[model samples]
Target: MSHYKKRLALLLLLLIGFVLVSCGQPATPQTVEKVVTQVVEKVVTQVVEKEVTQVVEKEVTTIVEVQVEPTAGPFLERARTDGLRVGFVQEKPFGYVDDQGNCTGIDIEVTREAAKRLGINEIICVHLAWEGLIPGLLASRIDVIPVGMAIRPERCEVVQFTDPYQAQGIAALVLKENPKNIHGFQDFVDNPNLKLGASIGASELTIAREQFHIPEDRAIGYSEQVQVIDDIVAGRIDAGMYTAPFVNRYIQEQGPDSALERATPFDSPSYFNTGHGFRKDDPEFVQLWNNTLLEMKRDGTIAKIAGEFGYTDADLLGEDAKVENCCSGDNWQNRACLPK
Candidate 1:
């Protein structure tokens, strides 16, 4: 029996013994009833407090519990609240800050629209050096690079890309007088001493060095496009290079009195396709951009943005403009894979 039950048994035995001892004494039946009633009530109260009440309270406390959030949110969800930081180089038509200090271009507009639709409103534009764009992205200094970086084999090994957005042909820049008589990559080969100037880490520079076999010593790298022009004017380099649209824009902006001119008779068999460049690890986020770009393309939004930058529908990406088709081993920027 329980301790409380044993105590009750002992108390009953004691009460019986007392009753027998007081049999001949003046012990009334009313006094016996009152004593028994008090003993029973005390035992019941002790049992309720010790067994029922304590156990019930403990069970209630355990059952009425809630879970607390222990971890932080996902990166993309956090990005929705935080600003989406975008990286860009000062390349015309694709991305740039104008004389008025307004940041606008095809890539910038495309990024803005895509990010906005994805529920990210604030876009922090980060201007980086042309060569620093990829490294900065790898280092997490910026989020993405939509500055028309060509989706080439070398870049494919370093980072990832979306479907091709636009195509650009390589162009040569020279003095107005055409002193070097440079026309194409072959001209650079003909003059072994002819120093070629292109922005460092540019696909154009890669083409000159890798495709044309222009030796490293002959291929000079500059931090800016303007530096190439400066070195060319100073006669430190025999020729400079850029995309056709970029060189043409520079020529037009400089007017008729400009010292530099686009090297005429320069043409390419293929166009280098470019796209939105981002980190390889974030496949889901990259897919979001690709989906939005598809929407833009279907609704003529991409074409409209292109037109703003002097680009036409012809400049639009071809159906075969994918990463694999655009980049193949050492043969970077496959012309056969892209539109003419």
Candidate 2:
């Protein structure tokens, strides 16, 4: 309450006390008349004082509210001041920490370039498992998802994907010596003894289970790409499924004599592609992301970024993987969406 309000209340109490005192005492007729007139004047004055006090209180509150209210800036501007948060699975050839300990990968670089154009300099990378990406976006734990998460009908219903960054395929990561002679999914199905591994929550794992009918006992799932490869090196499984880009980068890093190799004649779907993810309700950010991606696609910036991580022209998605084509079907054909 304002000071004026407090003073009026005090005066009101004083007037009531004076009225009571006058009534209790035996007063002369002139004195009684004077007391009644004084009481009337005091009541009128108190009522006026209350009105003035209320007006003063309202004005004071308005002034304080105006002074404290914040003025929010644009998202990009705010991000530049703070950092742009980008979420990705904790896997290589997408988003991972390298030997130098910088959070980087093909998808990360692709997003970095796009963000740079949009005037967002710092990339705050949030590493998560495959299942956590969408949930993270939903919970506001992260802002953008730049990873190998392909667009599917069910996923489309929740979050919006950008024009695809690339059309990729699956690779059977195997031993360099080719002792198992495992070329593809057929090898695993043909030989009950052979075990296949894939990253958990990956569509490839689902396809191996549901579509390919690979026996559950023969199929192994790991939480991260690193786990799959580590187990593969340890000979826990005959071969593993990985994104072709990941395989390519792995082969480059590990060299010819490395313990792992891509099992070619690996009859895997080549049309499976992926794009950046955004919340459906955030259309403005989604548009800016899509526009940046389209520009990157047109100017060959995405391709250049991909080459640094072992991605070729064949894997690049220009018009083929636009978000418009994502819902046509879940099959990874020429349109590119299905699991390979």
Candidate 3:
């Protein structure tokens, strides 16, 4: 009995000891293997998510940069951002405010086309007296002087000009009755008793006083062509002289029954080349206009505009016309009359 009992107790005690050691020790592979697998899966998932997020961010950034690069126009975008400010005189045949309050005529038409090609959305014309154009340009109040300004050297020294676009002869206006017998500019020169009428700041007065040797007292300057023509009609002055188209425009506008008539034998400082004027600082602007004008002339746009004002192609300058010395400078010499 003792031997059997001792063997069984010893076996039971050994088994109990083994169970207690297993409970106190770390987990076996069955539970621990699943936890390690879960941790590895989480790490891989985080790495893949981060890589995808970086690639998506880069793609989004590239797309934004590619969508923003255009709409700036040619040559000094800021200068014409608000559009051009053209200045014109209210002189017939070149520029004038019509009864409808619209600006019309040769110079205005030419300028409007150039402004359109330059990408300007607006053309604002400031009406100034003939004498005020140069000052208005220098003061920056005006961008262009498209008032059919003659390209005199004295004018060249102060402001800038586009290449000559017009060349013209001068004509005189007299009463239809021909009481004064003023057929041409020379008639005024020959008759000391006669007083000649010219617009203030016009090339006509300069030519009369300087080129023709007419005394200043015998020649008078009026502010507008109407003033000179009015005097001629009223007989306050013997004759009024200006560019041929100018006198013709007044006569035509006044109807067939008007007392004014074009005096015979047109005279001149001879072959005055006229151009639109601008500030000297505007070389780019002037060049732009020059190129555009040449293009217009070549394309027949210039001829079309001139024709509207009763100007023939002869009234327009050729594509290569340059300012010659015929009546070029402040001395106002008719180089044709000078010693060659």
**Which is the winner by TM-score between candidate 1 and candidate 3?**
3
Which regions of candidate 3 fall more than 4 Å away from where they truly are? 1-76, 173-241, 255-267, 324-340
lDDT of each: 0.75, 0.76, 0.72
**True lDDT of residue 159, candidate 1:** 80
Which residue pairs in candidate 2 have backbone atoms (N, alpha carbon, C) closer than 3 angstroms, thus clashing?
331-338, 332-338
Distance from true position, residue 145, model 2, in Å? 0.9
Candidate 3: give its CA RMSD in angstroms: 22.0
Clashing pairs in 3: none
Q: What tens-digit string does per-residue lDDT give for candidate 1 at 1-340? A: 2565556745775674487457864446666556555676677677777887889988887755322212125546756887777899887877899999988877898888878888988778899999899988876667778877878887888787887767777778898878888888888888887988999998878888898889888898889888889888999998888877787577766778988887776755357677788777778878777878877777888888776665645567744566676667544455425433
**Which candidate leads in TM-score?**
2
- Which ten-residue region of model 2 has the weakest summed lDDT? 331-340
In model 2, the Cα lDDT at residue 189 comes to: 78
Clashes of 2: 2
